[model samples]
Target chain A: MPPVVKIEEIHKIYDSGEVPVHAVRGVTLEIERGDFVALMGASGSGKSTLMNLLGCLDRPTRGRYLLDGIDVSQLDRNALADIRNQKLGFVFQGFNLLARTTALENVELPMLYGARKFTTKQIRERAMHCLDIVGLSQRFDHFPSQLSGGQQQRVAIARALVNEPQVLLADEPTGNLDTRTSAEVMGVFQKLNDEGITIVMVTHELDIAHFCKRNLILRDGVMVRDEAVSNRSFAATELEKLSSAEAAAKLTGAKT
Target chain B: MRFGSIIKVALRALMRNTMRSILTALGIIIGVGAVIAMVSIGNGAKAQVEAQVASLGQNVITVFSGSMSSGGMRGGWGSSPSLTIEDAEAIEREVTGIVGVSPEVRDRNQVLANGLNWNTSVNGESPDYPDIRSWKIASGAMFSDQDVRSVAKVCVIGKTVADQLFANGDPVGQTLRIRNIPFKVLGVLDSKGFNLFGQDQDDAVLVPYTSHMKRLSRRSYISSILIQAASADVIDKVQKDITEVLTQRRKGREPDFTVRNQVELAQTATATTQTMTLLLAAIASVSLLVGGIGIMNIMLVSVTERTREIGIRLAIGAHGSDVLMQFLIEATILSSLGGVIGILLGIGSSQLVSHLNGWPVLVSTASVVIAFVFSAAVGMFFGFYPARKAAQLDPIDALRYE
Candidate 1:
């Protein structure tokens, strides 16, 4: 079968006054199904920009991005939005849960945006199922303010997985988590990957990048290191260091 | 997205700001209330005017003693024999439109009962007087024409008089001693409430003209003559005919009398009431305008406050129409609430006025409906721009709004 993702020389040049800032320049890439890849780059290295183009949130200036083998660059805004709704799921740095909404309601918001939502009683039941996957089934009624940072991020991951999307676009998913909590989050991603959900995440952290099977490093909007991670490891045992002596504080995510 | 979900979200957002919603509805309340109250007051005044006109008797004319010149104290001004019983007879004989003619002799006397006495008017009038005055007897028979020609000593008492003399029993056939002269009771008159002259029409008695002529006789003079034409349409013509005849009888001199009809009086009073009602409504509508401004102001504040919420809703795939519909509904709801409150208050206020001032105020259902509809329209009109502003917001900037 054809590749699950494809890019044909995609370019993104943002107009800042008279100067043209080349946020992404002629980047060509592809990934097969069930691939766990990390787009690694420094600040302004076009990795996040390429992720956005793939997420259908922004368009490439002069190239085609074939997400799941569908050319997104030629599509209009509404069509692009339809693809975003149907195919892709997002997890951002700040965990972007609706402020006043409960965790379950936040997970249910995306399902409500698609057609057949009214007839989709299964959408509500499935939201619970995803929350179960993220280990937040008991906190379905808790609002974002009532949950800790790690719990909030778990809620976001539950939202991304609730649709059972084809690809997960995680923009620094563990950027706000502690070192131990980051490992715990990576363990969840690895487990989801092993269960056949494709993950394409962006990060500058070397330890975070090492958890994925494939890595693409970028500098000045150009890929310089495209290599396979040697061991494709996760530090799930790092969570054991905080599990003892400070179990309550670490589990509750208290500063102490 | 499902419409049910949209509505649920909108309702939740509305519940977030309670005071603003209530304040927005205040305008609609005042507008509707003012309309209902003004209409009720107008109805009251119209009815009052009709009743007052009824008291005077429609199409009736009056001819009085007047304008005696080069004479004594009661001489030059009102000592003329212009309204003699002969002239009353002449009008009865000559005027084509005159349906009935009653000559009157008004006098003030101490009306003596068993022990109580009252200083009430005693009208000396012809037997045709009841028909001429548009009167209906409540209890006994009116004196027949025989009472006028044979000059019987019989009288009809009004309701106020009957209440005083025969407080527990019938006044018919009872004898009342007027100026030490006994007159047998003939009938009791139907009540004619009060009039502009501050006189209760029921507080008087009527006697046969001949009996009064014999007891307090006059040569050819009457206090006033009561005349009813065949209909209101011919009243003015008949009045002109009577005045010309009387003027000629008084030697072609101006007759020095007032000729009035019910239509003119009703028109004058109705017009006055209508103007007063419109003025009241205009005054009340100023409050409605202020309420509208309050709605607009609160909407602006709401738009400012929910920027982040707007962004979240948009990002979750809320369409532009959804945001627009939500804000518009909020504005309409607010205005309708105010309208309801204003209607209740307006009716209450008008009822209070009616009770305090003895005026009739009727709040019509038509006016109430008008007020409610007007408030809703105003809400939509004032709510449009702010709602549009909210709907058109860019999700990127809105999410970043503090």
Candidate 2:
């Protein structure tokens, strides 16, 4: 059986005026179901570009991209959008929740866009369940602006989980959090992965990458290493040691 | 994106920026209001002109000799030196379109009846004059054609002249003087009030024109000849025929005489009034254009301000069409609000003015519809660019917008 993600000789060129810069030069990678993978690279190494392509926000100039064994390389804009909504969920580094919207509405966002034929009560109940998964069941009425950065990131996680996407892609999901909060988020990802959910994340920090079972490193738009993390750092006890609010307070500085 | 959801978001977002929305809508309001007010005024003037022309009697045509002027209107430029009692006799004799012809000999002067003597006009004309001018005898008859032949001293007095000359009792068999030439009143004319020109028709004394010529003035020249055509359809042809006859007689080659058709004159007056009214409206519409520009400016700012929100929505699965609709609805709501305000203002002011002047005003519901449609168009027209800008924003970049 094929892996859940398949890329064949993908080339992404950014055309600036008359010059075409090779943003991603012929990368091919794959990951099977029931795996947690991390793409690690330094800044300007096209890590974000590969993440954008993986998330279906952009298309490669020339390549065959297969997500869940479906040929998605040639999808138009609207089709790509629909695929993103139904097949993949995204949690960005900055949390990217709507500032004026409440936590519940933010979590309810994906279900509203989905074709699940859910009623208002069902949508609200599912959103509440997702928030409960992220352990933010009580902050549903607070706007994103009122929440701390870590809480905001958890709301984004709830939003990503509300529609039960086939894969959850987190791009530096703990980049804006402190050590304690990052450990807590990693614990949540591990717990989710243990429940048989497919997870992919991007990070440049080696310790953060250690939390994942598998690691993929990119350099100069090429994957240099693909390996499982050995003796990975586990934050199983640390997450339980601190409350979310106290853990979230550790991420008070150097956001983004 | 769901179309209904797009509109709902747009409306909610617009509600957030209350002041911007209202200001934008103000532009549409002014445009719509101006349109309604201008059109109503034009329509009112049209009706007024119709009433004034109708009062002049439907089939009336005046034959004077004149060429068309540069200013577009003048009555007595006929090259002819002669439009005699003879031409009136001939039109009465031969013209098929001629309904009635009264040789008008008007001489303005003061007249004395009693202690109530006042300045007034005296018209020397045939009995057909009153009926052609739609005047009815209030108490006594108009002077007969025999009175014209015999140059009798018989006279008809108007209501103003009647009230001024005789305080009470009948003015019949009463004596009045046109510059101290004693004339006995044979009858009193019905009140015709004022015509469109504000000229008082009931402030006159009527005597036979030939009597004015043969006895008092001792001149053969008729000041003007009042001719009534059979109907409006024949006024132009009758005008042409009158021109030919009078020009030949006065100028002997091509008469300089002017023949005025009441129907044609009425139409010209109506046209002039309509053009002026439209010009006023066009001037007012310029302010509406300024208002639309104000809307555009505010909408553009709003789009920039909401860039992050737009990005968030897009990431959540909103298409470009969704973003565009949201902004467009905001603009539309703003303009519609303004339109309602302007409509109320225009209606209120026009009513107040008409009431104060005691002038009849007709405001139609069609004007309201037209104003609203124009206001909506203004919103769409001004909102399009900002909407397009909002729609064209990239979701990734918008998410990162500060």
User: Candidate 1 overall Cα lDDT vs. reference?
Assistant: 0.79
Estimate the lDDT of model 2.
0.80
All candidates' TM-scores? 0.72, 0.79
Structural similarity of chain A in candidate 1, as TM-score: 0.91
After best superposition, candidate 2 residue B98: deviation in angstroms? 6.0
Candidate 1's C-alpha runs over 4 A off are A1-33, A45-84, A119-123, A163-167, A213-230, A235-256, B1-7, B19-138, B141-155, B163-169, B175-184, B190-192, B196-198, B204-267, B341-372
User: What level of docking quality does candidate 1 show?
Assistant: acceptable
Question: Each candidate's root-mean-square deviation in Å?
Answer: 6.6, 6.0
TM-score of chain B of each: 0.76, 0.81
What lDDT score goes with residue B155 in model 1? 90
lDDT for each residue of candidate 2 in B290-341, tens digit (9 for 90 to 100): 8888888998998898888777667666667767877777777677768778
